[model samples]
Target: MTYHHLTIDELTMIANFRDQGVKAYRATKLLHRSLETVYRVYRFLAAGHTLQEYYQHYRENKAHCGRKAIQLPTDEVTYTKAKVAQGWTPDTIMGGHSAVVCGRFTAFSSGAILICGPCR
Candidate 1:
């Protein structure tokens, strides 16, 4: 089954339901959400946090869940481009051909690194 995030309206309804002393299980039945999903929001509100705060905090957490952007130094990017223009393969560059210019870049495949570089 596909997963979906709850919208702000549903979040507010959950908060309103809890405010009226409605139990989480019953609220879940009405919202078509899992008991745990509704209950998590209930528990957060029960902890004295506002629904807006929960939404803001939820968005912040979701934004952080991904591969961080690759971070190579400017000199390394310049060096890689120059070497590639000179008919050099990425494998040769990664395999110590230009170790003096950039020993920091990792394994390269099809012009892209298998893992992001700048380990330090």
Candidate 2:
């Protein structure tokens, strides 16, 4: 979706609702805007300063949704054996072993190691 900049009027409305104790999600619905947009503008207007600070914080937080991608681990002997039996290439085996590892471990906790291996 295309993201338009929050106008001064929209920011004012968000701040008014927040000051009146309206929740962020509900306020977003009331404004007919995305949840993130409402949240960023609420924080921006409430900070009692320039909107740029709020935009910056929103961008930073939005980018902080964890690491981009993870690699598999080489120490997983079971995965290695399975790959060998399947006659898969090293790169293919490494990238495709995530589902098997996730079955044995939490997807995020073991994700990096399972995708790239311990070497990475």
Candidate 3:
């Protein structure tokens, strides 16, 4: 089955049903969602958080759920900038053939490295 994020109206409805002493199973039937999904929503509401707050927090958490960014060292960045300013190609700077420099150059060309300027 396809995944579907619950809307604010559905969350409010679940909260209201839970407040009226509805069980998780019944709420699942009412919302046509899984029991786990219904229970999760009920638990979020029971914790005294509003639907908007839950959604905001959910979005924040979702934003962080991805491949971590590559972190180039400050010294490496400085070295790259110095070399680029001296009219050295990224390939020459990294000793002719380096996968790291190649990848970094690709990322740089795509605006990841603003200080490098336009690579020659």
Candidate 4:
């Protein structure tokens, strides 16, 4: 199954379960989530921290999640776009391996090239 972040309600429920002196394992069984997943949120905040504080922290942390945006130099970006306009696929341009520039290689996915190292 695809991964998904926890919702606010789920976070609240986890906090509630923690408040009731219930173990994280019990919340995991009820929430159909892994123990670590439930426990992480349960421990996201300590006593005396308000729910809003939890939410604020959640939002801030969420901003750093998700796929990192593709970051290539302007020249590379232009070259890739030009190659793409000519009917070449990204994987093909990436050579199904690494884009070696000046004898250096940047790690990229086999299926997609998100970023390339400085080849200039």
Question: lDDT for each of the candidates?
Answer: 0.75, 0.63, 0.71, 0.68
What is the number of residue pairs that collide in model 2? 10
TM per prediction: 0.55, 0.37, 0.51, 0.52
Residue-by-residue lDDT tens digits, candidate 4, 1-120: 676777889888888988898899999999888898886676665656777787888789889865554465566656666776798865576673354332224423333344644443
Indicate whether candidate 1 or candidate 2 has the larger TM-score: 1
TM-score-based ranking: 1, 4, 3, 2
lDDT of 1 by residue, 1-120 (tens): 766788899999999999999999899999999999999999999899999999999888878765564655666667777877888876666664454332434435324643354433
Where does candidate 3 clash, by residue pair?
none
RMSD of 3: 6.3
Per-residue error for 73 in candidate 2, Å, reads 51
What are the runs in model 1 whose C-alpha is more than 4 Å off?
A: 66-120
Residue 32 alpha-carbon offset, candidate 4, angstroms: 1.4
Question: Highest lDDT, which number?
Answer: 1
Scored by lDDT, model 3 comes in at 0.71
Candidate 3 least-lDDT 10 residues:
111-120
- When summed lDDT is taken over every stretch of 10 residues in candidate 1, the lowest stretch is 101-110
- Superposed model 2: Cα runs more than 4 Å off: 45-120
